[model samples]
Target: MGWLRAAVLGANDGIVSTASLVLGVAAAHGSAQSVLIAGIAGLVAGSMSMAAGEYVSVHSQADSERAELERERHELQTDVEAEHKELAAIYASRGLDPVLARQVADQLMAHDALDAHARDELGITEAFRARPLQAAAASALSFAVGSALPLLMVALTPASMLLPLVFATSLVFLAVLGALAAWAGGAPMGVGTLRITFWGALAMAITAGVGMLFGVSG
Candidate 1:
């Protein structure tokens, strides 16, 4: 689920930002070939950037988690009895009776002291641990895939109708991406789709207007 959110966000940003860039350039009176070239360049750059950024960020987070886990493990080893009491108290605070909490904590500590403390005290779980490489790859791949759609439209569409066609198509793609993201995250699909499309349309519109203004002035 976390990976899904990262992938979707990567893809969505790729699509919206690249589309906006291409539209702005196209409105500035560039040739279709030029626009296509720019779009492709943007896609490649954006994907690589996203991947690198995600990698670095996730790696930092993973390091932090590992450091915390190591500290907890050392604490548990140095003072097992105290750690046990701490775990029991945590459980008791969460509504368990004192005797039952102590028994449960002892049992958990016996099985895996570090795991128990990390999970209960530090709120660190294997399920939520960061994966730097996986996140980076997912971000890069998804960004490239998303960027390709608008780039393809720009390349294949007739120049006479390129702007409008690209605008409309990109909005549809953004909406689809939003709906998919929302569904994956167990959110309201319609609301997510509408929100994405609305913002995407506004960005493209603003870029196009600015481009046209620049073109006329030039």
Candidate 2:
């Protein structure tokens, strides 16, 4: 679900940005070829950008986790008793009685000290650990897939029909994306749909206005 959520967000960005760029170009009375080319370029650039951004962001988190774990491992080596008490304090803070917490911490540390401390003290677990490559791939793939939808509209619709068709269909795409994301995350589908659609609409409107201004000026 975490990866799914990231993919969904990346897709949403791809759809909204490509759609808005194409619509803006069309509004400016750009030729069909011009808008089509613009959409393609946007797809390529947007996917790459998403990939790079996700990689950098997630890599930073992974770095922090590594540094913290390294420090914890050193502490465990130098001050075994202190680390045990620290782990017990954590368990106590979570509502366990001090004696029980100490006993549990002792057993856990004896079994696997680093793993226990990593999970309990630092809140770093395998399931939740950041994987930069996975995030980059998911973001890039999802963005390209989402951008393809709007590009298809550009290909099929004639110049005269491009603006309305693109806008209408992109809104539908966003509504579906939002609803699916909401369902996956156990959120309100209607609220997600409304929120995503509203932002998409606003972006398109702003882009169209800018294009009109430029078109009129030039």
Candidate 3:
């Protein structure tokens, strides 16, 4: 589930944004065609944006991790004693006795100097390691899937019922998604559901209001 966070976030954004866009246009008394077009446009734009953003962010994290590992590797090559002492100090600070810390560090270094330093010193681990392509794909695919839900409502629902249906359905989807994501992350499901629903409601409300205001003035 390394990609769960990005996937959940991307899907949440996709649902909220496309639903909000559809609601706004519908509130403006736009035709079915206009609403569908807006939703589709929002979906495409949001998916691409999420992909690019995740790629850049994860790539930066990967770069930083690589840089730290390389620095540690160089230190191991040029100053093995210093690296060993530094690692021992880390273990000592973590509550091991001085002698025990030194012994533990020596054992770990003997087994794998680079890995020991990378995990303990640089705080890099296999589980949390950044993968740019994985993150990008997860974000993009999740977004498209989420966006499709609201757009489906637009396609099926009549113009008069479009706003209400999309609003209600989107909120339900967001709440369910939030709860599921929270469960995955071992957090409180209720809190996550409420948080996502509240934001989705607010986004739709604001956008719908704007659309109405313009509609009235025009």
Could you estimate the TM-score for every candidate? 0.95, 0.96, 0.96
Across residues 58-119, which tens digit of lDDT does each residue of candidate 2 receive? 89999999999999999999999999999999999999999999999999999999999999
Please say which candidate is ahead in TM-score: 1 or 2: 2
- Summarize candidate 3's per-residue lDDT along 88-187 as a digit string, tens digits: 9999999999999999999999999999999999989998899999999999999999999999989999887888889999999999999999998899
Q: How close is candidate 2 to the true structure, as a TM-score?
A: 0.96
Give the clashing pairs for model 3: none
Candidate 2 ranges beyond 4 A from true positions? none
Best-to-worst order by lDDT is: 3, 2, 1
Task: List per-prediction Cα lDDT, in the order shown.
Answer: 0.90, 0.93, 0.93
Candidate 1 Cα deviation (angstroms), residue 178: 1.0
The TM-score between candidate 1 and the true structure equals: 0.95
Which residue runs of candidate 3 sit more than 4 Å off their true CA positions? none
